[model samples]
Target chain A: MKKIKYILLATIIATIWGCKPEEFGPIVGSEENFLKEMQGTWSLTKVTQVDQNAVSNGWPYKQLDITNIYPYKELVVSFQGDASGKPSTFTITPGNSPKIADLNSGNWSVDNTKAPTVITLTNNGQTSTLTLGSYANLKNGKFYLKREKKVNGKTILVYQYEFTKK
Target chain B: MKKLILSIIFILSATLAFAQVTLSPATFTAEDEVTITLDVTGTPLAGTQDVYIWIFSNSDLPAEIIKKDGLTNGQWTNSADAAKMTKTGTNIFTFKFTGTTLFGQSPAELINFGFLAKTKDGTKQTQDYKPYKFDPLVFVPMQFRVFPSKMDQTDMTTVYFHQDLATDQNLQRMFDVKVNLVFYNDATPVPAVVATRTALVTVKESNILYSYSFIPERLITLTAGTKLTKFTYQFTGSVKDANGANVPVAGPVTEVVYTPFN
Candidate 1:
């Protein structure tokens, strides 16, 4: 009975330690690291607007390019390309401009995890929010962020971007 | 015994987890002049709890009508007279009203309406369904009448125009005005009236028609010396009651003529 109690206690301790939530430390990363992980600009390589029945794929599959401009403090995203095949750039910034034509700024947070990491961005005074996912394959020196999603019935694989560390 | 107890516990847990109130047809649309039906049922406690539905126009917040089903005192009674509380049921309610009744007959008229439910424990809940609005319909034939036949040439013309409120009869006391006047030179249509004025009249107990005129302004600009013959005025206004239904005004197009002195 004593041995059994000891085993149970050991199991409980292991469970608690393993179940502890993962923590993402404060936003810390070098500009080179950010560019390496995020730069090289991505374009919509594939697009599937609707499924077989012409129903919404439940993903924003619209083609848009993401270019990383500026450094850590400010990021700006310029929607340049044409309606179908266009290139855009995203630059980090602290605030919005009065003319509204030049720049757009918002609060952003990033999460680094396994294959699919997340970056949440908010704009319009917290009225709108969007989550972006990034996939990195270090062995191949390739990294990409999801820009759209692939829909199969109820399942979806959001579109991503490919980049090489510079 | 322990196995039996565990089985009972699992069954109870499952039942509690699945218990929920199922509201059917969660969305509604009342075509121009149609009635909307809402059906609700308690998934677990259907008969034990009674549901009360209240309809509010232009409000998405919870509102109480006097209880008329002999439920409570001093509470708003849901009687046959109240236009809002019609056709109450155990798990169903129907709301009916014409487009012109809910929102005045005008273009792009947006009016808000909401629904509420009360449980037996007096727990009241309200719905924030998107507001319902009436798109302006083509011109509906309407008439208006003016009072006092005599026109005083000395004191700039004071025309008293009145129109019989629409059939809905849900007008509040406040109102607005929109007018169009067509004057004629001899027999041809000529614009004469450069500026226009309006007011609300109240008849006192002493048989006096008290005039409370609003700011006189020009609806249309006219050049000086334009001949005068006939005037066509169109007025559009709304009066909301305590329940928010528009109270109708009565009469025909009120017209005033400038009779030239020989």
Candidate 2:
């Protein structure tokens, strides 16, 4: 009788606890499988780069229009699922800029665990890097990447190459 | 104990009521946030001259003041100066206070409220309003979906509904309110809200809404990876009466469609 009473008490407690409503549902497979999700080739969908130094100086960040940028129109970045599991090549048909004329194939890897995941690419024997929001941000059928560089000692943003997986 | 219970009952009765002040969606849990509005439209409280409202538990109030708190438009001053209610809409003093935050760790199952809406000098005031019950009578769903509304058969798409308490007073008088949501694709009998594959709903970003989500890909699989074009959802809400029988709230049974992919 005592055992039954204890069981009944516990059952009542559990039922009462279950009656509460939940605010947020668990998002399936969020940030858990980082490396496995990086298998496919991702195209640049949208990009926004900002210079923090310029922003603090009361200057607005420049937003690049990917559709109007000639070089971006012909660029295709492919990531291979080969042994090293790195980006295999970056192919871009030369446009107006001389910088696009000599760009070569590069290896790429995304450190998805970092606060702002870093995307590292080696092209033309020179390594270049940028940061992404997260794997979830990437999985949203779009790729967003940005970087900051200085030109003539004037800090500026090199923005907006966001891609989605096909 | 019987006298105390009777006394408490007599206090909440409408007889001692003075100025009318109503707290909407008073039924709340520690996980909930309620917007308590002080409608001081017609009275001397029309002009803002340091008139403020503070909320306290029934235990904190004096026995006599607690008895008189339920009096509508009653001139009551606060015993505790903890929180200052902010002014929101016109002639209305509003404050969105969190349940769990107010109750802290050791909280009562149901918090009995004692309110004071008065000027700093105790000149203008409204009567106190105590809740009749704890469980709210209506659930309003807040709906939203993922970015790529259209996706590959393998790709995941999330459809979300945030369960929220209706601030309207009409629903509050009812009891045992609950909602049942049904999601469907354009031409199939596939159910998007199956328990086996559904994600576990645990918490909310804000205390205002209780969120529930469903995925489209798991509902029906296309053999050739066919692209399904559209989906829609229909939800029905009901509240119970004195006899515990469910009473349906009247609304157009319109099946809201998912917005086309942007």
Q: Give the number of the best model, judged by DockQ.
A: 2
Error of 1 at B71 (Å): 26
> Which of the numbered candidates is closest to the native, going by highest lDDT?
2
Cα lDDT computed for each candidate against the true fold: 0.36, 0.45
Per-residue lDDT value at B104 in model 2: 41
Residue lDDT tens for model 1, B32-109: 334544444443323423444444454543344211111121133332233333335664445555433443322233
Per-residue lDDT tens digits of candidate 2, residues B62-81?
45532222212223443234
Q: What is the C-alpha RMSD of each candidate to the true structure, in Å?
A: 29.4, 24.2
Residue B80, candidate 2: Cα error in Å is 5.8
Kept native contacts, fraction for each prediction: 0.00, 0.00
Q: Calculate DockQ per candidate and list them.
A: 0.00, 0.02
